[model samples]
Target: MKVSVWDTYVSREDGKQMHFDILVPSDLKDENTIFNFGKSYLKSKPFATKGLTSKECRFCHVEQASESIEEAIRSKGYYIIEMENCN
Candidate 1:
């Protein structure tokens, strides 16, 4: 199994910043499980839940992010079967 981490920054109304760290497991099959876990983790954090919603497993533009995530995984000794955004 491989794991990928994503860091997303969203702006808040008070000029502060909110960050969401999303962890995606390569072998994860159930989207609902991932979403639920992410939601629970973010909700338990100290920050107010006003900015970006909880970290999401499905990204609209995941190509570039997936490439970066895959590289990071490879560095950690995971065997990558396929990768995108090589450039």
Candidate 2:
């Protein structure tokens, strides 16, 4: 499946950065939905900052989804690929 990748960076309360990619189907063009997905992901993190907006997250590109990513998107409407400082 093809997915749109939204590159995201959020600041942690401890003054670090969290970098991740939010992947949704390529046809999904709603920024609000994408940002909400990001917000949901933040809620799962201990370092979650209270802000997830267009400034922190932007549409990066569209690419083929890996099997795991496709499965995740199929189940939850989106998938997340953590890039940095996510632990």
Candidate 3:
């Protein structure tokens, strides 16, 4: 997968802005697998698994991951939204 940093944008809820990186995978199948793996991994985290006590950014990351999956499906392409919440 090839990753590229894109422009950043401020979220609606807060004044804080974040940089976004887009990951473009050569193969669509790989992208699908990666997305699923990411979701499973994040959802398995203690914070996410516990309840609503998780940080807001954690929830945002999950939403972003879901968006990436949809983008891949709609365009028949691969992409990821890398934010500070991501390692």
Candidate 4:
């Protein structure tokens, strides 16, 4: 049950800076977890997402995400640790 919190940043539709921490198990490497994270994150941050489509969510766009970020996420395990909005 080990966990790690990775700090990251994202820009809101209005250009506001949002900081966040993604918590994941130490051995995560599954795409389903990423999709689930996107689903859950959107529900928790509707204002930030505003009018974006599912494909527009950061978690859903892992392929285009920074390599380091994706690597870190995959290296961990397939379950979502926690998505903390640090706005």
TM-score for each prediction?
0.40, 0.96, 0.26, 0.44
Model 3: per-residue lDDT, tens digit, 1-87? 233222233232233333343334333334334444344434543332221111222212222335556567357443545665332
C-alpha lDDT values of all predictions: 0.45, 0.93, 0.37, 0.46
Against the true structure, candidate 2 reaches a TM-score of 0.96
RMSD each, Å: 9.4, 0.8, 11.4, 8.9
For candidate 2, the 10 contiguous residues with the lowest summed lDDT are 43-52
lDDT of 4 by residue, 6-86 (tens): 444555677665554455554554545644554555567656643333333343212233445556556643333333342
Model 3 Cα shift for residue 78 (angstroms): 2.7
Off by more than 4 A, model 2: none
Q: In model 3, what is the error at residue 68, expressed in angstroms?
A: 14
By summed lDDT, the worst window of 10 consecutive residues in model 1 runs over 78-87
RMSD of 4: 8.9
Whose TM-score is higher: candidate 1's or candidate 4's?
A: 4
Q: Which candidate has the top score in lDDT?
A: 2
